[model samples]
Target chain A: MSMPENEIREIEAFLFLEARLADESRYDEWEALWTEDALYWVPRRADLDPAKEVSHIYDNRQRIGTRIRQLKSGFRYSQTPASPMRRVLSNIEIAPAGADEYEAGANFMLMELAIQSTRNMNFWGGRTLYRLRRVDGGLRMVVKKILLIDADEPIANLSFLI
Target chain B: MGMQRTIVYDALVHRDRVHGSLYTDPGVFSDEMDRIFHKGWSFVGHTSEVPNIGDFKRRQIGLQPVIITRNPDNEVRLLFNRCTHRGNMICAKESGNTATFVCPYHGWTFGVGGEMRGVPLQNGMGKDFDKSAMGLANVPRMRIYRGFIFASLAAEGPSFDAYLGKARKLLDRACDMSPDGEVDLSAGWLKHRFHANWKMLPENNTDGYHVNVAHASLMRAVNAFSSQAFDEDKGDNSVTRDWGGGHTELDFAARYHQTGRPFQWFGGVPAAKMPDYVARMEQAYGKDLAQQHMIEGPPHAILFPNLFLAELNISFLIPISANEVVQYYTPLLLKGAPEVNARALRQTEGAMGPGSFLLPEDACMAERNQLGLAAQSPEWLDLRRGLEREYMDEKTGLLSSAVSDEITNRSFWKEYLQLMSSFPGAAA
Candidate 1:
């Protein structure tokens, strides 16, 4: 049976809002959308185990908090002249993962314009797999795995979150 | 009646400043590739990368394509990836296991040990063609020290030990930190590039003066993010040492931090897991050794020309041109300790990843520096911080300077001046 329209709409709204919050740099709101114990990972290479290989980002809640704090505290040199970003998330697919948990996969393309003393414009496209848990009748992200198309290539500074 | 002689690279470098053209000139970049990268012993890949027989890992050394493979006798061999037939690249895969690499162009195959084994059409070359005589050209010199592999293209040069000199101790310390007496490099790599001369990276590695300005934001954020207190200004608590042969080290304070743990950032590993991890380390290395390992912080060691070891990661620079360089950052794992390895991998990603907070700022600074070098107004870049405070060691013939000093850069330039002055192309 096909998923109900309401459920699909709910998933779409949730994903879009999450992307909007990140792009808008509303870090506190973004943090609130995550479950207490969350695993956020951006792999260096596709299909590599985090335990065996390295990742671009592999932060639990505390590590995530650290990154957020860095961004928010105005002390992150890379983000001093924080990049203005716009994220386009599409091709979203959602399905039940476990009890009260849903798995969502989506493709995203983010354009960021960073202006420090100089201006650097960056474009990044990636696919994201998110495991979201239903808490208090609302969906909260448990894990976010971002897989960039050119993970193995020698990329420039990706200071901003993808 | 005194005769005067001119040294080729003497004018390029000065006591406290170097010519800006040295950073932006393409001719200078090419000369560097030939004189420094090609002639010197540059790090290739580790032995653990191809542990099993017939396994191969591809590497490029100053435009020369090389393949590191495990031979049938279980020995490591470095071979040129070029095919003898048409010079097509033999192995394109970054890394894999295969007994024979068949050239797609003409079906010529070579063994993992670098011997030409088979040809699709044998009759074409005639029976007089010597199969055994034609094999892949081997790199002139290949040396393995503590599982780290370094390759030299020059036929004659100083021995690897002579080249390493006091820098060998840094490698030993990194290896000894592990209970197994060896470090594992099986973890994959993080590749990045910045718009600056490749030399800027090594200089930046030991350049403590820029910390407060270039990385002020990162330090401030890290301090604010963590519950633990930190002395962000680490200059007073550290020392920069020059170990000759362009090798230098930044030994930061171990007081505000613990070593051998991989992750130094506050809130790095879970608090409850710290004791258990320490217990595991103590169980494996005994109490005293483990204690020493924990207290003795990891030194940021930069081997002349290319290799750099920072904490649990070994990053090497491949100079593409005057303004572009590719960096391969491989996070090393402790062999026996899974927890430590896991932590190392995570922390390495956070520290060196493309999206890392620290390196991005450094990259921006490098790009800015490169752009600033183009300005003819300021013809020199200063390296004169704490120059007068440097003290030479009589025994090892090394130099030590304050942590905030640019002595590392000065020492590196000293070796650079020597090599570049003696360079064949420079003399020509």
Candidate 2:
């Protein structure tokens, strides 16, 4: 089923909000965007049929929370001179998967300026099969899978959310 | 002016420390390519990566591009990736199985084994043009230790065994863990490019002092495993021994601690399975070595110039630029191990894989160190940890060690200095 114009605008707005929160390092707000059982996955292979290839980051809500806690913790040395990153999301295409669920596809570019190093950029686009459910008068992400173009290529580190 | 800069290289050398310029200098880096990378038996990739006939992979040996392929006869061959006719890259993809490689630039084709098979517009070339003589230039010498392959650009060097010296025992033990005494590279890998001097990494591996400080997060995560096996009453400590010619091993007693906490393998294996693994290891190596492998914590073994065969996996540090290095991690499994055992091995590798809980922390530390080196002050970095215990053993010609030692780093630099110096008796 085709997504309603209102639902499409809502996803684009949601993605924009996510990009701004991450860019400003407001991770707490970003963390609040997910459902209790939501999954955030960055697959290691381009055609990451989850049954076959492993994911780089396969975080459920609890795991994602733990990551946030670590990032906030002063002891994480890699974040000493914390990396600054900005995510650019564009070309949003929203389609209905169920009555309330919608699948969103968008092109993303994450540019990270690690302290004392030149800017490193990661570019990729994929359809996000989000099982959005209405909860407390807001949409919550049930699942997010990021299929990077160079998923199999050697990467330095994904210190921040893409 | 360039000659004056060359003199600056001589001035940087000192007894206790070397200038940071040595790590940052382009001239020094180029010289290293000629002396160390080009001359030494640098690791390419494991033979298992190209197991089937027509399987091939592209690898960079220093700045040169080379392709390693398995011929129809099952012989492993390493050849320049470029087509001889037009200097076009023969194999563009990173890795794949191909019956023949055709260069898209001008239709020059080569066989899986790098033999020149065909060229378009063959009639246009004079009859004297011999295609038989036009095969891809093979790397000067290639040798395999077990299933691991190393290629050298220079034709002459010590035999592979002689170069490995006592290090062969370590590789043997790693391979012997499998019942079949072989290893396969099938579980896939993690490749990352770090913005740091390549030498710093090899130096860091054996530098035990950084574990408590640089990798504190990883240490914290693995603390649960360490606390259980540690015997506080034993008072056994870690040791870093230099196994001459730039190879070294950092050994920690089964219960040694950093930050007053015992060191542990990051992944936890069940107590029940440990004995079975030990028994299998005992069968592979004799009783004494098996006991050593089990009782002693895994050793951090660094084969100088860019190969690190750690207890968990193998990493190749290929220098891409002065400040950029590509790190490739290949998980090694004992050949013919049971499927369940392979799964366990994969789990262990996953704990250190690209998306592992540990690598991000390690990469962060390395990058931070690189940033620190860019500073104007602190011209010399220190490597004086446990300097007093770097005693050379008379019988084996190896250097013994103690806890908190930089002996391995010192040994690495000693060889680095020797390699960088111009060949004696040869005129400039």
Candidate 3:
């Protein structure tokens, strides 16, 4: 069944804002949007069991906290001079929800320009699955799982959050 | 400022430094591919990759691609992917199984054993033409230690055993850690590219000097999220060794497994599951040995020139050119322990996957190193840190040093120099 129009629009706006927070390197604001027990996963391959097969990023809230902490440390050489990125989110679909949780899926295209001794731009497209819960009449993400089109291929860097 | 194309071993390689051209010159990369890679026993893939009959996978040793397969007869064979007719690649798929590989170009078919089976319209060739004479060319030497398969392009060199030497013990240890004394590579792999010379990676794998500075971001993140999970002040005592013949290891398991606290990398397995995991280990091995295994950290084993088996994964390094390399990271699965295997996969994902925090940093450093090598003023890359602290074993000629010592790189260069200099007057 299709999502209600209002829910779809709300989810789209939330995802867009989430992308904006990361694109602007507003890490602290981005971190706050996640629930206490959040899960963020990026599978290395489209057909992989994160528990059995390896993932690009299979993180708990603590791990996400660690990642943000590292990125903020100004020593993550890969992102020391942080790559500038813009993510375009589209095709938002809100799946059925539990008592308070709504599952939202969206397609994203992230364009990143990285300058590390040389200038290179990468266009990464993927489908992101997010689990959002109603918190104080707004929404907070409990899980975000990203599956990239070229997940199995070798990439130079994915230093920035996608 | 003119620099000679020929690499003079004595001038280019020293106790502490190596010439910058070794990282930049395309001619040197070609020579090394022929001399070092072709002659040396480079690892291609594991037997586990093609476990069943008719299973096959394509792998590379330097620039040459070969198909690693287990035929219907259950014999593992390495067949050149190149078709005999017009030198076109016979198979394009990275991995799969077929009783016969048909060249799409001409429908020329070859068996899994690499024998020429059928040629489309054989009547076109002269009556004297023989199909028996034409078959896929096999690599000169193929050997498997435990499950790791290594092949040599040149016909003669050191025996695989002799070449492995002390490195063999570590490989055995890696497998022995598995409850059933077996490891499988069926899980699949992660591939990442770096704009750096191939040598930089093997060196980085064994170098402890970069851990503090290069991986500081990782350390800080882990510490911040997990109550100082990677705080340096905790006094992690690890050691690195040059296990003769260019093989090396950084043994750091003991430090992490101290007091049985769950490591930050594995996330926090439930406190109750910790004992159960130990019990599973004890079931496979006796109480004493299981405890020893638990206490000892897995050594990151780097076999000479190409392959590295470390912490539940194997990395195969393929060089595309002087300034480019591809790293294939394959996770190792323990035969019967689903929980341990899952944890291992999670830990590998957290640390080394393409989007993970650690590898990208290393790639940046390697790429920058490549760029810096272009400068003419600093003619040498230094490997001089902690040289005096190394101790040599008189019997095996293996050298041991602190985990952060430069002895690892020095030993690597020593072997590299010997191999490079073995070429008579100049590199062809």
Candidate 4:
């Protein structure tokens, strides 16, 4: 069912905040957006079963923390000089799931200047499905599944918050 | 007719050092495609991929496209992915279960076995055209050792047996992790493109020295590499072995056995997580052997030129050019252990992929190395770490050293030099 206008605005604001945090490489802030039982997945294909097939970024809460720690550690050379990235999200579709859970889908086109290795412009576009639940006060993401446009092909180092 | 073999490999590849040209020169890259890959046997794909007849997957040996197909007789056949008529790729799709490959370029159809089954307009062609001789060309040499398929395009060189030699144990160690003594690759491959030389993959994979330095972030974030063997000073446990014939291993079996623990190699995953798996292993190979297998886990080795039996994952690199390569990885899923296989898939994701915690650092380093190689000042890359400390192991009859030693690098170049120099002044 269609969500209320106020609810939609809150979800959009949360997604925008998450996107900005990730774009700026604000590891802790971006990580804080995730729930205790979080699943941040970047699957090779949308239909890929996590139990059967491997995804690019399949992190549980512990792994999410570890990923954040590594990024924040200052030694993750792949992002020592983090790639300057900007993503534009559009055509968002939001729907209420379970009790307080909401599902939001958005198409994003990210332009990353991959300064780590090749100082060339790397284009990354994908459809993301975000599962957000109302926590204590703010909404937290339970799942952030990214379906990259070129997921099935040979991929370069995507060590960013993408 | 005009082939200039100007590159003297003996001068470039030395015991303690190698020229940077090996990583940058286009001429050298072309030669490697022939001398090392095309002429020599290369790991194609696992047999478990094509379990039934008509199953097929697209593969590449060097740059030549080929198709790995299970024929009607239930035998694995490697067919060049060429339409016998117009030279278009017959099987363009990555993989599928197909009875026959029809070239969309025309109506020329070929059976899964690469036989020229039917032609659309045979009446138009000359009567002398022989369909029997017109089947898709097969790689002359093919061998399967413990379900790991290897193929060679050349008719003769080093036999697959000679190529494998003592290294067969590496495959054995990898396969025996499964309760059924077979590993599966059904999880699929993650192809990570690298803007670096192919040699970097083989050399860096088994180097062992770069782990602490290159993967410092991963070390900080994860408890996976809690092994003392990874530490430089405390070295008696994990050993770096040159398995002779180019095979090298950054062995952690000794370190795991010391703990008397199962799954230490697998990030200390408790045996309780996979009770059915443990019980199956115990029943299959008895308690003692199964415990030993559990303790040891899978092999962390690069099987010579390409295949990397990377503990719970299988990885291999396809060299594209002097400055480019694509490394593919898949979880080494155990045949009978669903629990272990599931974990292995997740582990592979966390360990290697482009976006993973560990391999991104490695990929970055490799690219930086490739970039730095453009400089003419640093003509050589040193491979002399732990030279004095390295010794000949009496048990395995191979050169052995500590984990951080450059013995693995030297071992690779030694075998590489032998293969390159075998055919004097032979141009690729």
Runs with alpha carbons beyond 4 Å of true place in candidate 1:
A117-120, B1-7, B224-235, B253-290, B393-397
- Candidate 3 wrongly placed segments (more than 4 Å): A1-4, A91-104, B1-5, B224-237, B253-277, B393-397, B424-428
Count of clashes, each model:
1, 1, 2, 0
Residue pairs in candidate 2 whose N, alpha carbon or C atoms collide under 3 angstroms: A154-B191
Clashing pairs in 3: B253-B297, B254-B297
Residue A99 CA error for candidate 1 (Å)? 3.8
- Model 1 DockQ, alpha carbons vs. true complex: 0.60
What TM-score does each prediction get for chain A alone?
0.94, 0.84, 0.92, 0.97
lDDT scores of the candidates, listed in order? 0.79, 0.69, 0.80, 0.89
Question: Candidate 2, which CAPRI tier?
Answer: acceptable
Can you give the lDDT of residue B213 in candidate 2? 60
* CA displacement after TM-score superposition, residue B270 of candidate 2 (Å): 1.1
- In order of TM-score, best first, we have 4, 3, 1, 2
Say which docking band candidate 3 falls in. medium
Candidate No. with top TM-score: 4
Residues B80-133 of candidate 4: C-alpha lDDT, one tens digit per residue: 999878799888789999988888887888889999887888888889978888
Question: What TM-score does structure 4 among the candidates reach?
Answer: 0.97
Candidate topping DockQ: 4
